[model samples]
Target: MSILVYAEHDNKNLKTETNKTVTAALKIGGDVHVLVAGTNCQSVAEQAAKITGVNKVLVADNAAYEHQLAENVSALVLEIAADYDTIMATALTTGKNFMPRVAALLDVAQISDIIDVESADTFVRPIYAGNAIATVKSLDTKKVLTVRATAFDAAGSDNSAEIVTLSNVTDAGISSHVKDELTVSARPDLGAASIVISGGRGMQNGDNFKLLDGIADKLGAAIGASRAAVDAGFVPNDMQVGQTGKIVAPDLYIAVGISGAIQHLAGMKDSKVIVAINKDPEAPIFQVADYGLEADLFDALPELEAKL
Candidate 1:
């Protein structure tokens, strides 16, 4: 079955999640095309064309789609839904915003956050905050899905493919872009980083969080915080890692001074190599940890920094 993937991007660069979604699309087994919808996004289209498994990149360059407003994006995707048997995107904020709308417009049930593609018709996904996995088989003629990116390896941009420009794009005129306020950080993006070092309520105060910075720098890891740390004003909400926040599966996840709560485990339990450092031996984080260190973080932090 042919597939169309929504290529999410800013004006400058394609988000890393798109590559992983493309990898998932390849498993569906057919000619895969990516739809790049944004203003002055020829660069984005060109980048998508080079993804290894993609056969074509469809470009819909228009002012109405600049910010990926759900109404217009849903309309644009619906206009071309008839040709493809499956349509999928990364299960990020952008995909979560519009995939349901597209599915509704096409009059089909949307399969959300699929982690594995057992077949073109059967898929595996998480249910109940990832407490359980469900393997669902959709009978819909036109299958629509949003893939959990962390489950798939990212597609590389080493191939050359054709780029086609879409015409007569429809504008729903229901939404408009106002302004964007972005948080700028020099550390690796938490979602994309290979290694992440996170703190929690055990960190005590905001200034105490400085204990993690040095270790993070030495490891070149992104700094994350539990809901407690963010709620306690130790960091911004964007830094929070839990069920209600971003779900990440890094290669190496180091939880310092964080008692692993169920909500927090829902986010990082999938990490490849989990290291938990807490004085309390019975913290739930230790149950799933690959390497558990029972020590005060204040002392452990310095030791790790010295060794790394």
Candidate 2:
């Protein structure tokens, strides 16, 4: 089987999730070809060509793909969809936006957020807020899937693959690129951080998030927030981590003043070492935490910061 994995990028550097998705594609047993679709993204294609298991790098460089709008990118993918047995991308905001349209256009089932590839046709995915695992077998001739990056190790960069530039481009004028308002942070990205420290509604207010700042700086960790904290206006939505938010599987996840709701757990439950600090003993977060600390965050924060 041959697989076409979408390479996620920002025109300059390749996203870490692309490497992880490539690893998943390799696991499915195929000649992995990465599709780098963006304007002035030759550098991104070069980076993808270095991935360990990639067989080829396909570049679709055009202004229509600059912002990677779902309408344009999906149309581009469909133009060459007939050659690949399986098409997949990381379960990121961009992938989620376009892959469904590709599936609908192809008239096939789109498997979402697959954590494991039992086979080329069968897969394992999380369901019901990650409370259950569903094993599904697709009967479609062309398989469309979204891989959960955290579940697999990233593919290394050691080999140079053949780079093929495609001239067949699609410009869907239905949607146009608008300005992007991004959150600039000095800390590591939440999804790729080795260690993460998150706050929740228990933080009381946005100013209290400073308590985690010292700890995050000391450990060089990324800061995240539960949906509650974002909803309460303690932080921006970008900092939120949960079922409806970004999924992270850091080596160490410290949850301060956060009650573990199922939605929140679905995001970070896969962390290697989970530490939960909450005054309430029955907060569901403690159930999944490898280390549970029952204490007032007001007192705990200061002491922990000093100790760090």
Candidate 3:
């Protein structure tokens, strides 16, 4: 039996999340081969070969495969699906966009955001916005899974495997294009950050968000927001952390003035250390907090900022 992992990358460089997916795939105890499907991504294929537990690297390089358009990618991955018993990818935008199509082509349900491996074919995953855990056993001959990076430790880059360049067999025609305009930030992404500090509706306005900025800078933490704060226009939708937003599992999570709703907890409950600061002792956020401070956020901000 062998496992196939999809390597996520830009045309030039591989994303770190690929290692996390590979780590999860390694737990299944099989030869791991990563498939890199894109134009001019031979370097990324080589990079994937350097990751530990990868037995071989497959590159489907073609000019038409640029941009990893879901149509082109799904077609390429499906062509090689019969060769492996299990296929996996990171649960990023790219994987979420294309893996479902591959699963459909194979007539099997895709196990999304898997957190644990029960056995070779059985797995544990989250559902209902992480409020429930589902244990699934795949009876199909082939299995396709997407791993939640935050739920698993990434693989180390210590292995030296051979790179095997594969021919691009699929017609890489895209009906639509997705272009990216990246906003560069010194702060890390919330989902992958080790520390996170999120604000809520108590901050009142966007201007007050700056109060958390200095503390975040001191703590070297990614900034996050509650759904209520995002809806109040205090922050952008990307900063939201809740059932409707991103899931995070940071080493430390500090929530200021955020009344923890079950939805909000669903996103951050996996964090190792949770700290909640709110004036109301009855706030639900205190239930999951490792440290709780009941005080006005406005008065506490400067003190917390000074201490940090």
Candidate 4:
């Protein structure tokens, strides 16, 4: 059976999430082709063609797919859906938004945030806000999936796959691109960062968040905040990490003064190493932590900064 992967990329380059999704596709073991749908995205397609296990690359250079409009992108996938047994994409905002529509149009169930491919049809995914792991089996002829990139290793770039231009295309003209107002930061993107240092209500105020700046700079870590910190207006909503916010699976996660609420754990419980620093010895975060430091963050932050 053949698999078609939706290549997630900016017009200039392929996103790292796509590399990880390609790793997931490789695990299923098949003729894997990547589809790059965008406007003047040949550079992105060329990069996708270099992924180790890709059998081929399909490029649909179109103005209609510039913004990845769900209607247009879903329609584009549906046009080529018949050529492959499974269609997959990274479980990021773009994938989550459009894959469901593709599934509905194909009359198939879409398995989301799949962490493991148990078999060709059975998959493992987090459910109930990541409190439970569910094994799902799809009996549909065509399987649609959004892969959790953090659960898989990125595919290497050691192949020279053939590139094919797709002439058969579809556009619904249902939406148009508006100006994008994105928050640009010098630090690593939260989802892609290897190490994340997050603050919580313990910060008490916005100015206190500056405490994490030194630690973050020392380790080249991204700064994240608990929902409490964001709710209290200590940080921008974009910096929040929780079930309600962005899911993160970093190599190391340091929680400062953050009470480990279930809501908070849902987003970061999957981190490889967890360190919780709170004066409360019994905070729920400590239960899941690899290292727990029970002390006032005010005292600990300075010492930790000095030691690091």
User: Which candidate number maximizes TM-score?
Assistant: 2
lDDT per residue (tens digit) for residues 1-308 in model 1: 79999998996678778899999999989989999999899999888888999998999999888898999999999999989999998888899999999999999999999999999999999888788999999999999999988889899989788999998477877677789877887899898999999999999998988889998999999999998899899888899898777789999999998899888998899999999999999899999999999999989998889998
| TM-score of each model, paired residue for residue | 0.96, 0.98, 0.93, 0.95
lDDT of 4 at 257: 91
RMSD of each: 1.4, 0.8, 1.8, 1.5
- What would the per-residue lDDT of candidate 2 be over residues 50-101, giving only the tens digit for each residue? 9999999999999999999999999999999998999999999999999999
lDDT (C-alpha) at residue 256 in model 4? 97
Whole-model lDDT per candidate:
0.91, 0.96, 0.89, 0.92
What's the residue-level lDDT of 62 in candidate 1? 90
Which parts of model 2 have CA positions greater than 4 angstroms off?
none
lDDT of 2: 0.96
Q: Which stretches of candidate 4 lie over 4 Å from their true place?
A: none
Residue runs of model 3 more than 4 Å from their true location after superposition: 169-174
lDDT score of residue 267 within candidate 3: 85
- Residue 267, candidate 1: alpha-carbon lDDT: 87
What's the true lDDT of residue 101 in model 2? 97
Best by lDDT: 2
Q: Which pairs in model 4 have colliding backbones?
A: none
Model 2 TM-score relative to the real fold:
0.98
Cα distance off (Å), candidate 4, residue 203: 1.5
| Model 4 per-residue lDDT tens digits across residues 14-101 | 9888989998998887999999999899999999999999999999998888889999999989998999999999998899999999
